[model samples]
Each structure stands twice: as C-alpha cells, then as structure tokens.
Target: MGASDTAVAMSTKDSSEASLGATAAGPTPAAGTAALAIAQARVSQTDLTGLTLSGRYLVTRKVGQGGMGAVYEATHTLIGKRVAVKVLLEKYAQREAIVKRLKQEAQLASSIGNEHIIDITDFGNTDDGRTFVVMEFLEGESLAECLARETKLAEQRILRVGAQVASALAAAHAKGVVHRDIKPENVFLLKRKDQDFVKVVDFGISKSLRQSSEEEEAVRLTQTGMVLGTPLYMSPEQARGDEDLDHRVDVYALGIIMYEAASGRVPFSGANYLSVISQVLNEEPKPLRDIRPELSEEFEAIVAKAIAKNRNDRYASATEMLDDLNAVIEDPTHSTERAKITGPRRLLPKAPKIPRIAWAIGGAGIAVAAVTIIVALLMGSKAKKQLKNANANPPAARADAGVATVAPPDAGEMVPAVETIKLTIVTDPPGADIFREEELVGKSPQTVEFVKNNKEVNVTAQLPGMEGTTSINPLERKDGAEVKIRLKKLKGPPKVIIKKTGETGPQKQQGGTTSHTGGELGTNPFAGSGTVH
Candidate 1:
C-alpha cells in the first residue's frame, strides 16, 4: 500500500493468488480496474465437503483457496489414495468457455512431463456441474507460507528453488505452454529425496502456443479485454497487454520470484492493482543489490537481464536462465561478474607528467620526497591529537634501528589534491617529550604527519635531568624511515651562568653541542650561525 519498493504479500492462507489485468485484448483503464477487482474477489464461498465427485473420489475438507477456485483434499473411493482436487466455482464451471480453458490447463500441465510440475492425474465434471482437476496431494506448504514463516530463504535454497522452477518452466516452454502467472504463492515446496523440492502450480491463466488438438485450435483460451496474471509478477509486456507475449514473460516473473526470495520483498508494490501495473509498465525495479548488497554481482546481473525492459534483452527462454542458475549451483565461484570487470583500470586522474631526465636522475628520491611531504602535512593537522604527556610511550632502547612502514598512495589510485608524509619519533632511554616545529606533540615513539610543504621542520626530544636532542633529519628520505634521538644524562643540575653585559655568542658545552639556556634541549647546530664564509 505504500509504494513500489514496499512489498505487500498476499494472504498466506490462499493456495494460489492470481491477478488479472489487460490481456492481449488491448485493455482500457476501466478493464484493468475491473479485472483486478474480480481477481481479488476470487475467494471460495461454497463448501463442498462430504460430496462424492464423479462417483469415484470422495470430497473432504477444503485445503486452500485462491484467485480462481478452491483446492480440496479428496480420496479415491476404490484406491483409498489421497489427492488434491482443484475445482472451479459453480458460476465459472457452468460457463462452457471457462470450463474449456480449465480443461486446457490440465492438458498443458500434464503434457509438460516435468517432475517439478504438479502431476495432473484426471480432469472431470461432476453431476452437479462442478469441474475439477486432481493431482498429487502435496504435504508441504506453498512458498508464500514458507516466506511468511521464515521471511527470506537461505542463499543455496534460493538457488535450488530457482533451478527447479526454471527446469519446470523450461519443460513447459518446450511443450509450447507459457505459464503467465508465476509467483511465490504458486510454487509449492516440500521435502523430496531429503532436499527442498519445488512443484509449480496454478496454470489457470497459462497460454498454449501450439494448437495440438481441434478443441484448442477452435476455441482460444485467453479472453479479450481481460488481462490475467499476478500483478506483483507481471512482465512489462504482459502489463501492457501485448498480444505476442512469449516464454520470456515466464523468465521475467521467475526472476522477480528469485529477487523476492533473496530480499524477502518484491521490487514493486502499490495500494491497488492498477498502480502496480502502472509501475510494471513504467518503472524500473530497484537493482537486486540495492536491497541485498551481499548477493553476488553475477547473480544480480542474471536477474537484471531476466527482467530487462526489452524482451530480447531477457533470457532467450527459461532454459537459458536455468543454465546460469545451474552453473552457480554447481560451482559457487562460477560467475559472469568477473568478466564484466576484467582487465586493469585507473580510478583516479593521471599523475603529472615527469620529465625523462628527472626519472633518470632521481626518480626514487622524487617519490620519497612526495610521500614525506604528504606525511608532514597530514601530521601537522593531527598535531593536536598527539598526546602531550612526556611519558606517553615509554621508549625502550633497541639494538637495531626501529623500522616503520609508510604507505604511499597506491598505484593507479588517485592521489589526493594535497600530498602528505609521516615521521615516526622514537628516542633512546624512553619517555622523552617530543616537539615538532616547536609545538608539543606526544612523547617519543610517536608518529606525526602533515602536508608535505617544502618548509623545513625541526624535531626536539626532552627528558628531565638529561640533555635533550634536536635535529632536522632531511627534506625527505625513502618511504620507510625513522627519526631516532639519543639523550645524555645531565652532568648535574643546570649551572646558572651569568653573561657579561657585552657577551653575545652562545656558550658552547664541553661536548660541542650547545644546550638551550632553559635546560630543555639544544637547538639545531645551524641556528644563529651567520656568515661562515
């Protein structure tokens, strides 16, 4: 009742629910509305329990009812075997035309000779003029019931059910019988051979392509101005009342069923039948992956093709669709999606053109420089996040240089508009506070990143009662690099040396490195040293 994406399931109590709209006989708006109304009102009102049919089978309680009629469980008096008897209501049974069509349905289904199809054993009219077709009494419930209980079928079960339905449909198509109505409600599921087995039912609106008999040739079953099939599963062509509908219609409907099984809902729905039909004719269904992204791309593609707007775009027939389903069932990895994306592709803008001379001279150096710059810029932005606590990462001295891996932009991966680099700060004797560009970052053993501008950045490490170290390593180095700092124990507490009034130059320490006057860390040796030449 909401919109196309909202699925409104039919009543699970119905064994077979069908929707009738415009048929090959071009339909007017009124006809579409009227047909849907009639289809919706197909509930059985009369109870025929305890009646003997054709003096052969004794009618029992009604099992389920649907758009066309009610199905009853009955037993043959002589054989004492139970069977399902589908009987037309008196109003429809008395109509010679409707009766002939029902008989044709039995003939068409029986002729298919597929095990997945319901087995129609007999078709006869009783003394009361009630027409019925008897078939094997299935002990399991319809797919509608299963979905109502479970919501969505498992993946393998979906494929299994789809394969079986396709097999049945292939057989029907080969026999020139096109099942115009295929939906969850019409598919019966039961345990057979210890596996989930499917039996396709409800051939009331089926159309036979071949005229194998005089009765079939003389009286066409499909009526004029009366389109028939379930609105939820109708193909676009069928919704349009196209006169030349073919087996692909069944293929499309089956795809919808499979889609429903995977997503637990139909792609289209509406408040009334006409609205649904309108969507079928005018709207494209949401992609199968949109609702359930985990579904394999290959599987989604198969369903997408089945429901293509153009009939030719769909599977040639149910057999063709069955082949793909079988392949998936046989080998889980078998898929067409890989072929769709085969070969290399670039996901970003092309890198700037580098001159041949530059590559010949220092290509690796240039690449490293770019990565470092990128890392530096990134670290600059994240500077505030770095823990300022001096002892954040208690550094442990290592016998060998600690190595850290820096990931550069992937090959063919688009480079961001801005490049960045990262520098890992690790110090010996641990717990030293680190400062980048004179700003407090986390303690040693931390990594800092920022945009790689050409400007030089100075790094400093500090520890109490020890001489801190500061160094400007390089503009850039090859991808994986580390900045290791070694701090020395202070000789004693700071010596407050008073400078003479005219003294200006820095007072050099005994070791050659000059410590800052504040007793934190020494500045870079190059600082304030002017005009060496």
Candidate 2:
C-alpha cells in the first residue's frame, strides 16, 4: 500500500487497539517482528519500535503523541542513555512549513542554555525521511497537571516558580528571542535530587527579534490579522494583532500565568475563544486579590503590572520583574503577612487570672532582696582576690588576666576590617559598556573594588552589535581577581541582494513583493493551531 493510504488507515483505528494487536500473538522474536510490521502497515505507515535513528537512538515505545508529532522513549544504543525522540508524523512530513517550524523549535530552544529551559540533544531526519528531534527525557508532571490536581498554589511556591521562569526568559531576551506562548502546559515541574525544578518547554511559536524589517513583514505564518497566542493568556498587543511586538508580550502572558496560579481561575476567561480575545484586547481583568482575598496586595500589583494593557507600563525586562519578585519573597514582613493570608486566623488563648498589683509587688520585693545579697557577696570576694593577686605578681598577674579575660571583638565589627578586593573587568572586544547590578559601571578593561564579604557581583556588557554577561564571585578566589568576558555579536538585519535575469545590473526590490533569495518567508506556526495543550 502507498504511504499516504497506510497513514489514512492508521488514523482510523484506535492507538490502543494497534498496540494490543502487536502483542496479541506471542512474545517471541519472530512473532514480535511480524506483529510490528503488521502494525506499521496498518498504523503510522512507519514502525518506530526497534528502529534506530542516526545509528545511535533506539526507539522503544511512544511516550507522547501530539497533532504535529509524537515523542518516543528512546535510549542511546552505545551509551544506554535515556532520551526522548520527537518525530514529525508521516501525514505532516510533506508539509514544508510544519517541518521547518518543528526544526526551528529545536534550534531555538537549544540555543538558550538555561537550566529552566528544556535541552535538545540532536535533530535530523530518519532513513525513511521522517524528521525528529532528540531531547532530555524529563520526569514528573506539567504545571498544568499539578494545578488541575491542587487547584491553586501557595504564595511562596508561586514566587519560586515564577522567578525561575523569569530567569529563563531573561536569558532568552538577552539573545533576542521571545517566547510568545507562556502557559501552565509549557511550564514543566520536575523532581530532581528531592527538589522541585522547572523546565520551560515548547518554543514552537517563539519569535526571533533579530529579523530585518522586510523579512519580518514578509513572514506571516498565520491568517491575516489573526491572533497568535492562547486567548486566556495572550497579551493585549498580541490579541490586537500588533506587528510591532517584543519581549513584553511574554511578560503579559507570564502575568496571566501568575494570576491563574494564585487563584483557581485565570484573570480573563469567557464561554468562547472570541469572547476571551475581546476581553483581553479591550477590557481589563478583575483584580487578582478580589478573586482570592487571601492574596496580598503586593502580589496583585506584580501581576497587574505584568498584564498591563500598554506594553510600556509593563516591566522593562524579565530580569527587572524577577528582582521585584525576589524582593517580595525576601521581605520578612511581607512573607509573614502572606502566611497569614493563606492560613486561617486563630485567636490567642486567654491569660491566667490574678491580682495584677499584688502579684507584681510580691515579685519585685523578692527580686530586690535576692539581688542585694548576691551583690554583697560578689563585692567581698572580688576585693579579697584583687589584694592577694596584687601582693603576688602585681603587673604581671594583671597583664595575664587581662589577656585571658578580655572578650573577642564583635563578629559584626570584623566585617569592615577585611580589605576590599579589586576586580578587573576585561572583555574580548574591549570598550564595551559595563553594568553592575543594572547600574552602569564604566567601560570594560576597568577595575572596581568590592568588599570581601560580597559573595558575587553581576556584570553586564553592552556594545552596539554585541552583548555579554557574567557573574564574578570574589569569595571563590583571592583578592585582585580578574574576570574576563567574551561578547558575542548579535544577529544583524538580513542583507538583501537582488539580481535581474535579463539585465546586467542588479535591481532594487521594494515592498512585500521583494522575493527572498533563498528559502520561504517564515510564519508563526501557532496561528491556527490553538492552545498547545
């Protein structure tokens, strides 16, 4: 049978039924191969089981299936290392745009090496022309699943998760990438080393900020004027189909995520997608604290700023938002208040009943008598010992006693005594503007002094077409330490070179009609795909 015919037939039968058919007869080697072949012919048009890709990954069984592709549990044949293999379905393999988008997701995600972002190991096409990407196999449920089971999360837990996500976004933004879709489904919660860790997944709709004006205008993957994000979590500009978008859209979606995580429901929702989109574009969401009165006003303010209708009103950068979130978490008074909000208020037990004046007078009289007797004895003993010590050694005895009896200096006072270390900042391309803790601190190839007690100093280098960042921990080394940073050139606008077939000279192309020299224009794949969940 033709490949297309087989795929059509496979789509008609249930996946479970096909799996049962593969193991119905026996577990023998020959029977297994036969069953696998039969199942392949009837479903998927390709037998992924027992198949090896790139002569390394051995596909075992399907772990996850999606509209565009399916993820299989695989192991490296030589190293026996576990990994996940996501393959584009045979049905969509012929769709060039979908194939490109699947590959783009892998490339974009792999480029950002953040702990909170999923890691892509490798990507290529199989011998049978099936495209696939290998990624780290993650354990645990998605944030969406957790929220479904627990409804809402605690205030501290929200901040912890939000901070990690914002940190990942900061790294992406530094590289000029924007994660247009931010929702619970994309936030994965994994348990490693008995601690909860988050990994942001699915960059299928992420936009690159490095594209040229012409390229950006030419690439419209979605329907004309159609919104490109989930209605419930979409930013105002995204819902309005504004072409001039930046990382702020991600901030808006993150706000919606925070709001939903704090309360059981999202800030904006309606019976239908259109209604939700309308609310997102034209109306303001109700205050988060109003829905969950237990939530603090500070928390609500953070969320409100994130989902602000005007992008200019939102946090300037993900790092700025993260700093504010960390501040909220570290504030003692705010934390205590948050605890009270989440927990039930309890009344204190009543004090014991007593005659207030009589009890206080009796206690005072006994204390005064005990103190007077103790003072008299201490004075007598001290005088006798001093006379005897003076007669024996005098100055020598006094000096010895002084050395032994004197208390050490306070711990707090010693902090200022340590000399500040000089940290020399040098970059691959010198003269880049340097920033410490978001404050501009002269140009690179400069030296700054920091107290030894300072554990770490964050440095950011910015130039016209290059940028870099690093953290220097003076405590890790001795004083006069030098931190060398390497700045990478940012992606520049695409250069257009037009050639005329008949004429000897090149022609200048203008407007959207300018044809790109190579490859088709890009588009947002999530335009008509709906919410990834």
Candidate 3:
C-alpha cells in the first residue's frame, strides 16, 4: 500500500488491529542494524557561538544537534529578542540538494504565523557557506520537561495541552503544512498566570504543498540510508518508507503523544527501532484506562479516537480532536459518551486529590506596578489647566501643585435606595472557616454583601487540617443581587484513601467523627506518587 493509505488504515482501525513485527512471516535484520546505521552518520559538532548570521543575530548556546544540522539559541543585537537558529554543518552545506530542502523547511514554517506552531523569522547562510534558519525562542519548558517534572500530568491539564497542540496542527494543515515530527520534545509548554500554553516546534522535517505534485509524490527528503525521526513517534506509513504521506501521519503521531501525556507511557515500545516501527503498523495500544484507570471516560474515548488504527475511525482533522477536548472541558458530566461507544462502566477510578501549592508568587511586585501606573495617571491629570471663559465662577482648585480636589457630587442628597444583596458560601461539608482573597473572613453557610459600585471581590473558605481552599468570584454578582457560590474543595495533601464502608479512611475530622471525604488530603510533594489513584 502507498504511504497515505497505510497511514489512514493504521489510524482508523478500532481495537482489533494485530501485532506486526515478531509474528509477521518476514525476515528481520540483525539486532543492532538500526543503531549501527544511526551511529555511522555522525557529523563533527561545532560551537554555535562561532557562527554569525543575519548581521544582528549572535548564536549563543546549542539546544540540539542532529544528523543534518545543529540548533542554537541566538539573540538579535538590536532588538535584544531571542530566537533559535538551526545551522547546517559545513560538510553537508556544500550539497545543493540538501541546502535546497533545508531552505524549504524555513520557508514553509515561516508561511504559517500561527501561535501554536513555532514562529520562523528568517533564513540565510554565512560567508563560510554554513546555512542557518532563524526561529522564535520559546521561554518555557518543553512538554517532555513538564511530563518529567510532574511525572504524569493532571487529566484536565493533559486535555488542555492536547487541545492547544491540536489547534496548531489544524492551522498548519490548513496551510498545507504537515508536521512529520510530533513528540513531547518538540512541544513547548508556556507557563502563564492562570494556565499553561502549548506551542509545536521543529517543523524542519515537515512537508509542505509548495513543492510540485510530482516531487511530492516520489521525492524522499532523507539522505541515503538515514533514519529521519525519533522511532517512538513515527507513524506506520513513515516507518514503512512509503512516499505518498499526508496529514493522517501527523494524526497518528499526535495520538502517541496524547497517549504518553495521559498515561506516562508510550503506546508502542520495543527493544529496537524496527520493532517499534512494526508495532506501529500492527499493534493496538493498551487501552488508556488500562494504563491510567483514574482518567475520565470522556478522555479515554478521546484517546481511543486519536489512536484508532484506521484513519476513518479517528478524527478527520486536529480540529476535531480539539473539539472533543473542549467539549470535555465545557461539561465534565458528558463523560458518559464513552460508554455508548465502548462498554458500560469504565468508571475512571477516583483520582487521589493532590494538594496544589498556594502559588501566590510576586503578587506584591505586580500590585506595586499597578499602583505606580495609577498614581502616575492621577498626577498627570492634575497638571492640566481648566477652561473657564464663559462661566467665570469656577470652583477653587487645590493648593497642592499636581493635585486637584473636587467636591463630591450631590453629597446632600439621600442615599439612593440602599439596596441589599446576599452572598452565601456553600461547601461540601456545611461549615468551614471562610476567607476573602486569602484573608480569613467568616464561616461557610454565611451570607455577606458588597455595596453597589464595587467592581470586584474575592471570597475564600478554609477548614482546619485541610490544605484545600475554596474561592468565589464576587465580580460575577451584580449590585443589589444575591449570589450563591458552591466551592469545590481543593485537594489538600495525599493522605486521603478509599474505604469499603461509610466511614472515612485514616484521617480524622474536626468533630472527631473521623470522616475525611470533605477534608483536605496529604502532601504529594514533587509529584512522587506516580499515578493519582
């Protein structure tokens, strides 16, 4: 079968796909052939800082090195902006064919300016004939780093990460760009205030439609007898060396990434590259539930769809994967949709609640900056002169230079119908100490109110011996209206456990009943507990 057909077939099949490598009646190569071949293609490593490109970009530290080229972190002298530059070595730089393909990589990536895909700025070669491509420098860690740091990500966070990557892939596909290499190392996780953002990098091995149809059909970009990509992520068609590859290959690769992100394990792992390649062709990944039983059913179905062995059974595009992910986020209750497609009762074992650290880092710095800006604006307005020609009787100005004072409007008038609003905090347990913006307030099941004209307010609840804190967004409430908030208990530490009866586990409650269900768990510092359950 052709590459595209093989890729489609592998991606669309359900769980019935058979194993390919060891059972197939084919002659396999020597055990170390793949590694031996990889070892022979070594090019001498050179310092990236030695090369000067684009006049202003100075290469700094080396980020990665591959068979074809090496990547370096570079900074623009004038703008002080950082970027990643991939430099083809001097030995391969003289080959016109390789140089042409390398240039195409930069052009294709540059054509798509979407935020999910790595941003490419420019490409050029130096006087010494070493070619380099300039790309944006991502500030945060790679998905690989994140996975390693957390070991395994939270179910919601994994879905969020997948959705972002899917959006990037959709944009690239719309522009006829297919990311041939989609792995954790190539995926960047940018940290923000509320959540993490994802970006796909390294389109160097990607294929684009800019090439002629004839070239696209038969041209193999890899050098003679060279392995192009990481074995774990290669799609079946890519492993089989078929030339008619397309977007479906990317889908298959993304499936593997999602699998790893959710379960902390690759779907197909073998002793060698060929075995891994064969498994991609014939094997079915162990169901996600089997690996991480605590993951939600909706997420399992999403993983199943992405990992389908037939292209038709899987999502038609990355956009479709993103849609499913967003649907789960919008309604976690819709998880039952998986039971309809699969079997009944794949209840993801309840995930052990892990305490999220109270990360109130540098709040003071941000507050100070905001206050400075507001003070500066107030001072600036005070210097403006008032116009009073026709109306000569103007109000007296303040004696302070740069400061102006005005009398309150209608102070003598009666307070306009003082309206009363009620704000109530609802906790799982009926009563817990309440707080507002981290400051202790009252107890739960209590009502409070803000006067009209208050723009925003925060309400929090805390229980003794519980690491969890519940907060409410008082800004959502309108003036003179009641607001009811149901605060979901935050995970405390990792001390909570399941029991067969109605009684709680080892932890004790405040009233001495020893019921710990609604209370905080224990500490899981560094995410040492591999699986949540």
User: Which candidate leads in lDDT?
Assistant: 2
Can you rank all candidates by TM-score, best first?
2, 1, 3
Task: State how far residue 383 of model 1 sits from its true place (Å).
Answer: 30
Candidate 2: tens digits of C-alpha lDDT, residues 1-533: 44544554554454445456657853455545555655665454455776778889988988878777888999999999999999988887777666766777798899999999999989998765879999999989988999999999998789888988999999999989898988999899998766569999888778888866664444335345566677889987887778888999888888889889898888778999789988776555665655787875556657766776656546788987787677667454444532211111111322322111112134444464345335534676475355335334523324322222212224443222234444445565667776654545566554454544546666677687787777666565333233556678879732222323453321221110111111111100111111100
Q: Model 2: which residue pairs collide?
A: 221-523
Q: In angstroms, give how far residue 31 of model 2 lies from its true place.
A: 21
TM-score of 2: 0.55
TM-score, each model?
A: 0.54, 0.55, 0.53
Error of 2 at 379 (Å): 39
Clashes of each: 23, 1, 18
Instruction: Give me the displacement of residue 168 in model 2, in angstroms.
Output: 0.5
Give per-residue CA lDDT, model 1, range 1-533, as digits (tens).
22211211232222122223244445556565554544443422266576677777888889977656778999999999999899887678667767877887798889899999999999897554678899989998889899888888777678889999999999999988999999998899999787789999877768888755565433444456557788899998888878788899999999888888888988789999899999887566665655787876556656765775556546777887787777656444555342231111111332333211112134454565456445544675353123212113424534353422223334454323444444445565556766655455566554455344556556666688654555443344211123556677778873233444553533332112112212111101111111110
Give the per-residue Cα lDDT of candidate 3 at 252: 70
lDDT of 1: 0.64
**For model 1, what is the error of residue 293's alpha carbon versus the real structure, in angstroms, after optimal superposition?**
1.1
